[model samples]
Target chain A: MIEIEHVSKNFGKKIVLKDVNATVRAGEIFAIIGPSGSGKSTLLRMINLLETPDGGHITLDGTDIRAGPGLTLDIRRKMAMVFQKPAAFDENVYDNIAIGLRMRHVPETEIKKKISDVLEVIGLSGYEKQRAKTLSGGEMQRVALARAMATDPAVLLMDEPTANLDPVATGAIEELVLRINREFGQTVVISTHDMLQGQRLAHRIGVLMNGIFSQVGTPREVFALPKNKDVARFVGIENIFSGRIARISGGVAEIESDGTVINAVTPLPAGTSVCACIKPEDITLHLVDGSQTSARNVLDGRVARMTAFGSVTRLVVECGIPFSVLITWKSAEEMGIAEGKPVKISFKASAVHVVEDTEVRRP
Target chain B: MGYIIDGLREAFHLIVSLDPDVMEITALSLVVSLTATCVATAIALPVGTAVKFTDFPGKKVLINLIQTLYSLPTVIVGLLVFLLITRHGSLGFTGLLFTPQAMILAQTILILPIMTGLTISALSGVDETIRDTIVSLGATRLQFLTSIVREARFAIFAAVAVGFGRAISEVGAAILVGGNIAHRTRVLTTAISLNTSQWEIGTSIALGILLLAIALVVNTGVSLFQQR
Candidate 1:
């Protein structure tokens, strides 16, 4: 387990990280999601002492690394980091994978066996002698992974590991990460801006903003109960409406937005202005009377735009509030949804998430 | 124009014939320069690695000091060493004033800064990722530097070659300190200078051409090593 205390850092006059605290448990994939320049990478670097914190300490396995004696190579052996850009040494593939083991004084025979094993694990068995500079971007990242895993580190810190790869390559890397965690039981703390990737990979996710972790929970918990508007927006909540509460009802609040009353799952005091969020997938598109669906909130509108998003077609229903719904291509065809056609959009009240009232809006 | 062609022909003739005087001077130059370059490299490599790897107060000043030494007048260094090794100077009892060892010592001083500065720049210019990866893999500080130096072997070799080239072509320091004694302390450059002063243009020009050719060969070898 790794525990981060109140770690704060300042670069000259600019504060990179304010009092940030978090804990990463063993054998779980923890993901940190944030926008650019939000100190996510800096926070990850603190775990390995690549970047030291100015204010507080970090502990691994209950030992305070920052306060203890100079962290020898022994301490480094326990944790490894994979950078956003794969930083492989200018050597052949075998040498790159063998370097960490060689540093640990692993014998020549063992080094050879470990390099072969790691290369095989990364699915590059026969590429031992290939120069790292000649490999493609994806292959190079795999080499970086192999090098880190060759030492069998207890913890792996990753910074936007797949942000540079294409979708197929990203998917492959994500699968590899999942396999590594499950097979080896190595704790992983990965930072990324791709919310969808976070949802797919993270057992638990933390949302960081302004050098502060606003919320931390499982993927479902975060999406269902985002602590604030920023997290809701960050988690791909498409239908975020800002309005003042018109009335408080039985376990629900009627919010007035753009001269229309909207119902949210959470109760709020009357006259209080707040933000309400709904996932694009949570909204249902149906070609029927507004009263047919079991959904509580129904709006009638014309189909302002339709786009064929891969694996799902996105329909923008220009109604009281322009609501976007993602449905499969088959469903879009079954409903005969197209641009300029009138349709009814409905969403369950339970799916409507209410967030904090802040001038910093997110959609 | 006639002198130039005649000089070129005589230079080729002396090289082909391996004249005894020419051979002795060439051999002395090779021995002294080789010793100086090896000794200087032995000292400079560690200093360069330290300068690049460690950060301390006055580090930049020390680097600048080395650069300053690189441009120091050879005659001034020659005079300084000459005074130190002279009979009347400090530690002058050993009588090293007019020996080939004195010439080597002077040339080593002249080229130490070249080796150190070039090595420092070469090692420092490598990819930072290489260092990060080595550290991430649990390498000790010393192991990390060793790995870096291994990867930077080509550049370090080039640095040594540069130092050797500078040491071999040096005339002022060797002549002043070694007294340019014949059949013993006279290296290629010293012999060229002495023979030219005596108006022995053919021999002087021949030795100068040979020295230039040797310098080119050394530089070519350095570049080839770098390519690998």
Candidate 2:
């Protein structure tokens, strides 16, 4: 387990990370998800001691890694990092993969055995004699991964490893990451700006923004219930409305926004100012008014704009304020959905996640 | 034109026959300049690596200063060494003036700046990501430095070749420091100078061809090393 406590870092005057805290559990894939320049890479570098934190401490397996040079090396050797840019030393594949093992003074025979095993794992067997610099980008990245895996580090940290790869290459690297984690159970921490990747691979995801983890939870929790507007938007939550609770009865609360009342399940008291967040996928659209459904909240609106993205169509519905809704292309074709078409949108009260309004808005 | 053709023919004959006098001067030139190049590389690589890795005040300025000295005049180096080893100078006790050792010393000094400056460039040419990978792979400080140096081996070899080319082709330093003493301190460049002054065009042409041939061999060797 790696514990990052209140870590802070700055480059000259620009604060890269600020009072960040997160814990990576053993044998679980923890992913840092954020937009570009959100400090995900900086956080990963700090965990590996590549970039020292200006404040706070990072501990590996309950030992403070920054205590001294001796301890830092010991801690660092237990971890391996693959950077976004694939880099290989100017050497043959076998020697490149053997570098870490040789640094530890592993016997030559054992190093050879490890190299063969790792090459097989990365699907580059029989490439031992090939110069690493001569490989294609994807092949070189695999070699880098193989090089790191040869050491069998307890923690494998990857910072946007597939960021520069094409889609097919990205899939291959993702598969390798999953296989390594499942087969070896090495604690893995990967940072990516691809939210879907974080959702696909990580056991837990940390939503990083403004140099701090705004929310850290299971992928489902973070995707469904982001902590704030920034995270909500980052996680692809498009329907967020500023409102105040008009009344609370039983377990449901009625929130008023833009002259419309929205029913959601929240324990916040009446008159509490909040923002109601909803995922675009959760809201269903019907052409007819009052279509039979068990959903609690229904709003009548007109499609203000329509944009097609591959198989799905995104509709901007202006009920009182704009609410973004996603529907399948076939459904849209069947209903003849178009701009200025009147539509009814319905969603469950539980689907409306409520967070207390923390951001001050200007009039 | 007839005399020039005769000189070329005589030069060809002298090389093909491997005349004892020309061969001795060629061999001494090789020994002195090669030794100077070896000595300069040994000292320059470490100094250059140190400058590349460490952060200190005036580091950029120091690098600029070293680069500016890349064109340092050989005669200026000769004069400087001459004063240092003159009877009343600081290094006079060693009696190195007007000797082969003094020539070697002068050539070493003459090439040190270019070698050191190019060594630094060779090291800097290594990608920063490679350094990160080395450290992340658990390399100790020594191992990291060694790995980086190995990565830059080809460029460093080229730097050494350039230093040798400069050292072997220089005339003023050898003439001033060694006094061009025939069959003793005399080397290729000094011998070429003396032969030209005395109108011994054939001997000068032969020595000039030999110097170019040495440079060609050194460059070819460096290219072959790079290929490997």
What total of clashing residue pairs does each candidate reach? 0, 0
Please give, for residues B1-228, the per-residue lDDT of candidate 2 as tens digits.
987888899999999999999999999999999999999999999999999999999999999999999999999999999999989989999999988899999999999999999999999999887888888888898998899999998899999999999999999988988999988999999999999999999999999999999999998999998887
lDDT of each: 0.85, 0.92
Worst window of 10 by summed lDDT in candidate 2 chain A: A286-295
Q: In model 2, what lDDT does residue A113 have?
A: 93
- Can you tell me which runs of candidate 1 are displaced by over 4 Å? A70-72, A166-169, A267-271, A284-295, A299-346, A358-363, B197-201
- In angstroms, give how far residue B192 of model 1 lies from its true place: 2.9
What DockQ results do all the predictions give, each relative to the true complex?
0.56, 0.68
Q: For candidate 2, what's the RMSD?
A: 2.4
Q: Write the per-residue lDDT of candidate 2 for residues A267-343, one digit (tens) a residue.
A: 88998889999888999999865358889998889999999877899999999989999999999998999999999
Q: Per-candidate TM-score, first chain only?
A: 0.91, 0.96
